[model samples]
Target: MTAAPAGRPRTARWLLRLHRPALIVWACLVVALAALLLALRGPLTDAAAEGWRQYNACQGRGRCTYDQDAILRYKDFAGYANLALNALPVLVAAWAGAALIGRELESGTARLAWTQSTSPARWLTLRLALPAAAVTVGTGLLCRLHRLAWAAGDGRIDTAKRWYDLLTFNAGGPTVAALALAGLAAGTLAALLLRRTLPALIAGAVATLGIAGAAALLMPRLWPAVTLTSALDEDYPNVDGLVVDQGLVSATGARLPIPDCDTGAGCSAAYDRAVGYFTTYHPVSHYWPLQLTTTALLLAVTGLLAAGSFLALRRLTGPLRTAGAAAGTPSTDTLAGAAA
Candidate 1:
């Protein structure tokens, strides 16, 4: 058995054991990323280049033109497509948090670890730190990718209805804000309530999924305070003219086809086209910041829940005998304690 080092708190002794699962998970994540890169890199890069070439060939004809700028935009947008692969890894990570405390409680393992050399708190804290670090770094990478998307695409990346449209879809977005908060809540709830690994794991999964569902549903509403203006889904009745918001030129700006209109009745066809195009005008410039603020609000809610979990974990030194018992958990142990 490994001995505790001199002068270190009992907490230090358990740190190694706590990090064991995290190390394994991180190693697996590395392998997965590597394999995915190897399998997808050639195909994805070629697709990006090909798409760029097509965009360049299609330019300025009013259908869908591609200039060098458009090519660069497509190239950058392609980098974040791997994020569609985000669900699997996220499922793994969300599970890891619950695994930290939940498993120990499951097999009566915590009774062994806690009494042998360390307090439950120390052991729990060490476990949380390892995976939390991994999430932090991993998400950071996602943020970088998002930044490149803006750069490579020359700021023309589609912000509407795109999966990566939200702030959390960027590299660090899921980890730092979503996964991290959910992980903490799941981990502690697993420990304080289930007191057993397998059940705790299930509970954690439910909690994570619940949060995701809730975020998708309610997060948009959180930014009513900061969302400058809502996108009006219903049409306006400027039948003779068009009303627009926030764009120098609309997304599909077409030249006015009607020759000098000496009067309103001159060319019905040209007027109809212009009116239709402008009526459909929906500027996306304000969309990004609105989305970002909403995500921040969701992150705040996550932080509050995680903090509650910390408080819950701190008071218990034993497995929770029932779901009801687990409900009482709460603590102020700090974020580091919920790391794994």
Candidate 2:
């Protein structure tokens, strides 16, 4: 085999050539989703909004007629788009773990690259950086488009998803991009730790999911919530957003959980001490704050994962490193054995 050129630019080109199929698939996915989101932001949303306006205008009148099909179509399209965007992290994780890192290590290709004047460190860095950049750009475009699509429907369509809806929330901000990066890092680390394809793929996906779940659980607390109280005689505060907590507030200014009482009399008795209801929530205005905070958190996790990948690479090639330093370079067979 011809000796591979030594330089970051040439290495990047080589990596791209090796991963062209995966890159093509990724690009296709992004472009397809981007097209869908563009429709949602423009034509689909307009039709749905028109349908809503017609329906609302015909309320309390005879022969109510509206473009119900348009409304339903928009709902279905938006739902699928949201779901696909949310699933991008898992797709990225699986590909990174199984194809990018794991397969190369398993097939001895990584060792071959290392023998061609590419240090294990540079090889790993290129793997992580190249995919990370692609993931960020692709995921970021999807996120922005999804956000715009959702925003175009907001308020205009009566059944449009709220800013707080988990699917919609995850699909519409920097959080998804951050999660994708984290997934790449997680996959890289898992592959390095396992040095096998299947196990690494599973571990990477699970790790990314665990990270996502943790971020979701902590999101409500990441920002300060607004507490709104309403007298019992009135309906609960009519605000719509991500609710942290809701319960009864006693006349003495004490918060209490709403007791489970079915019968009217039972409910009255259960709420006898309560004078009003209180709600703690993050309003629409807090959307950016929550997104930015969660992104910062996932980025931190990604950094740690990248660092761990490097450490695992060091441990895997310890003897190779010492030998290479002493004799200018270790043999390809030794690198392959270390990888195995």
Candidate 3:
């Protein structure tokens, strides 16, 4: 068999190294999560049903049963259960980000990989794309599955599904994807700036989260997308002070009862004083636009992060001695492992 060209093979080798250490480990963990999530489906279904029953029982006595918003809050449990019970794909992704180019530079391996047939661009692309693609697919697939369950539970396709229904829900939202891309970008940026694995890892985590907050805080300001309002229209008169129009929630919740809600008084002899409250109000949202903008922004973040990583990789340099360089540490190990 003919030997492969120096370029493709060398670049492939670097990527394979990266994947073996990070992306492959991420894939394996995702498989494990998918299995676990599947395994518990029966219990979760039962729980949801039981929870519903518990709620209604409370209502019979005119008591608030489950917190109306618990449905939304509990969704995070899916992601929590996923991580608390098993390995987390995000942590693994973070670890991988911490390591990526940093470990290689730390161990002086990038020099070896780059010295061979791999040109800077090919080397960087291979190094970055394969592992990241794996991360995206692994996380994205799991998120897609999680959303499947959630969408089935809720009638409409939820655009900003909470982080916990499954970490995967976060995958669908623009902010989370942007944050994720920021994570990878932060890693590559750290790789370029720090060279040492440990510092890069720490810096990457802090920077990514910081960027996420700032982006969430500031980006929408510039983008200024039309926000959605979440009020239910009932038969209540539109008298201003008679009802308080609530601002939209950042997440979704099960329908709440207004004293005279749903334009009917089945709940109370007073024609559902609860019914009247909501009767005059309805939860309004533009599902179509919310979903479209969210999807667009998320895709944009993915592109930007990829572009950032590509640019960072193009500028990568070999490791240099830091001030008072120490040989090894636990943090360093965390940043250098295959799981990283």
Candidate 4:
């Protein structure tokens, strides 16, 4: 068929032409979120930090005053933005399943395309590659912006997000990008398996949620936790650290619930000296290790899903090719008939 025009430009153009609406929506969302993050990093964070400084300096001065409105506004925007970023994977999965692949399969457009100069494998590749690139770039940019916005308020604003918080952990690192890719792959897989729009969309979103939920539950255990044991009278070390578990430990090495003891003389005297507090936590240094490990696991899942999609495509096309050969013409109409 004249060598199919030599490059993937035509295929990419076709894919973009088919999915222009989704692409535009994604672009607008990215731009909006990025603008919000930029504002957070600059004006919002500054206002909140200034308010905190004022409040801290004026504490117990009887006439303390600060811009409470600015703090509230900053916190509101930060929280909403974080929520949107964390939900990006579900959005990607929905679009990938409902529009990208399922619609094509349901409407017979994919089969028609295969009847043209394209093979089922190439069609599936274009379906996945274009969306993967777009999702990766968009999500990766958002991750960087989120990290910048989050770090801008760190140590300055008292209510800034902690590293271990769910939204913060996913949004501020490579984990979001990895999740996006995984969602795309999952959606594509669901679309191929279902071959129907609505069912595929629901299945894809559910699959994405399952993957993200599991990752959230297992992330803390991926690395060895650091344990810090200290005398109950002494303050716990690294109070700002991401504490996974903390409890009181007896001299016999048995863990126990922390006693309701305060710093008062009576409480301290009643507390047993042999009962110390032990905190198992992830220090700030473990951030990259956790992020990278989770990202790797997600990317591995994406690869497996992509491979499965290709294999599914081959299985789908094998009988059509056989039928076309049997007809001796092996033309578009013959293959299209076989697909039908």
Please report the candidate that would top TM-score against the real structure: 2
- TM-score for all predictions? 0.56, 0.90, 0.58, 0.85
**Predicted structure 1: lDDT:** 0.48
lDDT of 2 by residue, 76-188 (tens): 99999988998899888888899999999898888777776667897787777667778889999899999999989999998999999988998899999999989998998
Tens-place lDDT per residue, model 3, 225-274, is 33223233444334321122322221233224433435555434333222
Which is the better candidate, 2 or 3, if ranked by lDDT?
2
Residue pairs in clash, model 4: none
- Model-by-model lDDT, in order? 0.48, 0.88, 0.49, 0.84
Report model 3's TM-score to 2 decimal places: 0.58
* Poorest lDDT segment (10 consecutive residues) of candidate 3: 241-250
**Deviating ranges (above 4 Å) for candidate 3:** 1-14, 39-42, 58-76, 79-93, 155-178, 218-288, 291-295, 298-340
Candidate 2 regions with alpha-carbon error over 4 angstroms: 1-8, 262-272, 322-327, 331-340
Per-residue lDDT value at 335 in model 2: 66
| Candidates arranged by lDDT, highest first | 2, 4, 3, 1
**Residue 7 alpha-carbon offset, candidate 4, angstroms:** 4.1
List residue ranges in candidate 1 displaced over 4 A.
1-17, 27-49, 55-94, 149-176, 224-299, 314-340
